[model samples]
Target: MLYNIIFIALFIFVIYVFYKKYSKKAKTIPPHWHSILLKEVAFYKNLEPSEQKRFQDRMMQFLAEVYIDSVDFEIEELDTILIASSAVIPVFSFKEWHYPTVTGIIVYPDHFNEDFEFSNKSESRRIAGVVGTGRLEGKMILSRKALRHGFSNKTDKGNTAIHEFVHLIDKMDDNIDGIPEILMQNMNAIPWLKLVHDKMEAINNDKSDIRAYGGTKQAEFFAVASEYFFERPKLMKRKHPELFKMMAECFRVKF
Candidate 1:
């Protein structure tokens, strides 16, 4: 009887702790953030008012759950809103969703390289964003310049933040080799790889509109193609029908 009583008490204690931790994430978003989203993010701006509310809820939930830190620059409201907005855009189709694999976000003043150096004097600082690995697992690092640039160039169809987050989604399946089994369960790896290789050939030959970097490999192809898919769905659908169809199905969206 004492053992049963102890076990029940421990279970209740765990539940209480969990509730206390997550309940704080449910607070309503601030009023001004809506204006920021309306002004800056094209993805958010295009959403229906009702869907925009849902997007705001999810974006605020992301801000609450995931901590954002800056390495050098002061983190601004635009920085936080853009980062959280990037995180929300990819997973918005899911009603109740958050990045379990991402622990936090670190924003650098500029691009960093493989050595993770971001000094202004260094020429090696070329990478825009990266999903952490090894000791830095479950973390994301972004270049403030690249992060803002992603949104500023609305027609480019390249968002470093979204690119990295797609990598995180790919990472969630424990294999970041390209296929996100969690998101693309309906699509098998073989066909996906085949499609990736075909498109990569086109990119390498300058015969495709998909980004050149996607031609690097299967994983990059997934992320790059996803950037295009989300950024300009109409163009992608009109230009690359098959790939867009796959993307729409993978994201579980009609468009």
Candidate 2:
């Protein structure tokens, strides 16, 4: 009876700990932040009031969990709001989804070089955003300017924050070669491959609306197409129905 009593007590303790942890995580956001999201992010503005509330909830959860800090420029409310929105948009369809591999986000004042090391001799190319790997895994870097630019205009179908996070998501399957293994069923793999190849070929031939960057590689194609999928759903659907359907299935979101 003593052993049974100890086990019950331990279970109750674990439940209590989890309850408190979750309750603390669900803290409400300030009204001003909601206003900022509405004004700054087109995605947030397009959501219904109820959906807006849900988005805010998810944003708050992300802010609470993710360590967002600035490198050179002072981070503002809008920056965090928009960054969190970018993270939320891709996985918004799944209520319980969270970016497990992404532990933190670093925002630089502007685009940085490949190694991001400031040295006159280093010949690194400037880039907007990059996902961390190797020893620096679980981290992501973004340009503050690019973060704002993503929300400032809704027509470009390009978002640096979303682009990098999609790369992170693509990495979940132990491969970042454009195939999202965990989310896609085995039966759909071949068709997905064919579509990726054909569309990439079209982009190479300049016969596709997908950015030329997508023609670079399979992984780049997935990330670039995802940008179009979320940012310009109508154009994507009208122009390329099959690619749109594939994106929809990959994300489980219609738009």
Candidate 3:
């Protein structure tokens, strides 16, 4: 009985600690920071005033939770704002959602190469951002240049930060297989699978507007599609309505 009491007390203490920690996170944005978002983040301008307020609130919370540290260069205010906004956009619809899988973000000076064993060649590529895995779990690395480019050119269907963050979201279910089980129902799984396959086929045939990189795999497809959905929503909706709808359902947000 004494041991049982101790165990229950410990559990309660842990829960209380977590509650206190998260409850203290900032939920409101300061006016200066709000202006920064207004001037710097293009996506913020796309939202309605009410949504713009929610976006700022969520961004403040994100910045409070996700530690942004510099890799080789000094982290700038715009970097933090843009990074926080990228993190907030995808999960904005789920008020209670936070990226538990991501512990922090590392900002690099520019495109850097990291050795990966994904292929037999063990080749290195100039990467803009990466979501951690295995021993590097709970972390993300992004390039300062790429982050600037993502927000600077709104018409381009690319946003490296969002792409990496989507990968993190895809991994929330303990898997990054492109099909986000957390947001997708089991009954709709097969349909989602079929849709991905069909779109990939069209991409391979050069008949699809989705970036060719998306056709590489299911995981890449999801990330690349998310980049396009958020950056070029109108083009995506007009060219690939079904895929756009699927993305809208998964994100619970309309671009």
Model 1's C-alpha root-mean-square deviation from the true structure amounts to 3.3
Model 1: per-residue lDDT, tens digit, 1-255? Answer: 999999999999989866654565556888988888988898899889999999988888888777899996799989999999999888889877767788699999999888888997777888999999889887899999999998888788798999999998888888888889888887776777788889999999999988899999888999999999888889999998988988887888666
* Reference-based lDDT, residue 122, model 1: 76
Model 1 is weakest, by summed lDDT over 10 consecutive residues, at 17-26
Clash count (model 1, backbone only) = 0
lDDT of each: 0.88, 0.84, 0.84
The per-residue C-alpha lDDT of model 3 at residue 179 equals 82
- Evaluate model 2: give its TM-score: 0.86
Best by TM-score: 1
True-structure lDDT of candidate 3: 0.84
| lDDT (tens digit, per residue) of candidate 3 on 1-255 | 999999999999989966755666685666788777877777788778998988888888877776889865688878888999999888888877788787789887777677532233445647889997778788898888899999988678999999999999899888899988888863388888999999998999999878899999999999999999998888999989988998999988766
Please report the TM-score between candidate 3 and the true structure. 0.87
lDDT of 2 by residue, 115-214 (tens): 7753345466468898888876888988887888887886798998999989988888778899878667533788888999999999999998899999
Alpha-carbon deviation at 104 in model 3, angstroms: 0.7
